[model samples]
Target: MNRRRFFGFLQKEFRHIFRDRRTMLILFGMPIVQILLFGFAITNEIKNVNVAVLDMAHDDVSRDITNRILSSEYFHLYQNLHSEKEIEAAFKSGKVKEVIVFENNLAKNIYSKNIGNIQLIGDATDPNTANTIVAYTRAILLNYQQELNKGSKPPAIIQTEVRMWFNEELKGVYLFVPGVMTIIMMLVSAMMTSISLAREKETGTLEALMVSPLKSWQVILGKVIPYLVLSFSITLLTLGLSMFVFHVPIRGNIFLLLGEVLLFVITALSFGILISSIAPNQMAAMLISMMGLMLPTIILSGYIFPIDNMPVPLQVISNIIPARWFISMLRDIMLKGAGWSVVWKDTCVLAFMAVVFLFLASRRFKMKLR
Candidate 1:
């Protein structure tokens, strides 16, 4: 390889990419797309499901049970039907996702020491979410049943005391808001920085940067520093929304949370720089970021699914995702109120990844440009 010719080519490429108006527009748009996707499109919690209630019993006890189901925060009783036929119409029309029914002799059976049925018919299109809603509906009815049985004790009581650790109210946005924000920031920062650097090569301006007597690290830092400011500001804005708007609590030290956020940002930036070292243009850089970072962050980082329950291969794959560490760290701090004492290991892992990527990217970049 002719070292002088290669370096000359690289500098020329950098100058071209930096000067393009379209390249500049994409650089800013990346952050916005990421923020919107994480905020609106992706979520794990289900709520405000519309339900129809049918009171076949048509007695005082049945009315009381109907009121109990309607009272729950999870289900909105939009349709109260007199017969099961009305429930069929509601389901057929798709206006209601769930139908609740009380047996005809609800009070009489309980008074005569008989067990009656409370039927829950759920829409199975989204099985996972529907299942959760059904469970919650049963819980409400069971609580009412327990109240009635308070006068008489059973032989064995299978009492379940569900304690949602870290998040007391189990707000969807509580853990999700922080985790999604981390993911969006990582995607935008990494993609924009990588694409910005690669565009220089695509447009043939990198030669100017290389021939200016500026150290390789200085050039890299110049591109990186501006994005560092932007990403952190976005993080702060997302956190504020979570706290003030969504009412997500921070149970851990603020300093520690900030430290982890910075670490993940640096780690993402390093990976972006690493991608830029090999990619020849903005299109390549964008494709690499989407396929390599954004998709994995959304699917395998435990952002949408519980990691522990996943297959062993996927769980192992998730170990390499940078967002996995950030997801855990943020959830711990935001929901559980975790501190350095709890997340130091994760911090160490992220720091190590950043340093490793930085080393590889610096060497690859210097060699590629030269």
Candidate 2:
């Protein structure tokens, strides 16, 4: 209620932040480092994938397709397998991702039936890579067929229309940005706030504040408001890196995106406050936040892995991770160009989390300070 006191409190909080070199580095340096690391280190694009070719036809058409697959930047022809028995060895050696087998009569089959069956045997150990290898091989074969058709008289050409939604280019950075933001926001808001508050408790400053005119809520607000500002700045830094450095586009409304970010920050801050309320010391607070919050956010938030592919139990557990809702909301906004109508459910879920966390943190705070 007292404007002067609140402004002084804010000034004091800002001093606490700026005076600490480690805190300043975390507030500014960590976001940039993390964004760059994740943006570049992890990627989905496959290149120079080793492949084995079994050319039974050994004819011009078969050889041409083999050359095409070999010359493709996506694949490298590792070796030529003599027979069916050699296919197993290539794959087992872990050097070959795919074995392209040309059937007995490829040129004859194409000339007569207008179709040729080329079996693609993939190493199912890495399903994603195997799938990509098959797709690229298919494209090469289709191109060859189209080239042959142009020279000859074909009765019909079945054209297949392909459409890639959200991420047309399929750059891994597009997926990484939102997920990185989720982890960073959680780290900055909750982990940082909890540790800061626990430090106050360890130092006896919290007791001094309790004895002062500051209400318990005011004390908690003073601690987190600085983090709120810092977290927003980190968000901006992340978005800038995502857009300018990585070229990840924001397809939806910027204001809406930021609003959702703020909501998530508040939720994380509240959760942090609750952690601080119970933690006996700063070390304990940091450990708890790292293990309890960061690990779950990374593993269960659908950041690096697809939720649909997770087991039924893990999928159910993922529902409780707030980052799950936040990441989906971000993807919907940035990738899908979705408005409130599309992402309203995710937004509502985040809002509910914010309310619940705030309530629990407040209750825990009153109990602790009393």
Q: Write the residue-wise lDDT of candidate 2 on 1-370 in tens digits.
A: 5767767777898888889998788767877887787666655557899999888988877888888878879999899999999989998999998898887877777777776778888777866456556767778878877777885886323222222112233456788889988898999999989998899899987877776777777778888899999899989999998899888889999999999999999999999999998898999999999999999999999998889889999999999899999999999999888999998898888899999999999988962454
- Candidate 1, position 108, lDDT: 69
| lDDT: worst 10-residue window of model 1 | 158-167
lDDT by candidate, in order shown: 0.74, 0.84
lDDT score, candidate 2, position 336 = 83
The backbone clash count of each candidate, in order, is 20, 0
Candidate 1 residue spans exceeding 4 A from truth? 1-50, 71-90, 109-117, 127-171, 367-370
Which pairs of residues clash in candidate 2, taking residues 3 or more apart in a chain or in different chains? Answer: none
Residue 189 of model 1 has an lDDT of 75
**Model 2 TM-score (2 dp):** 0.86
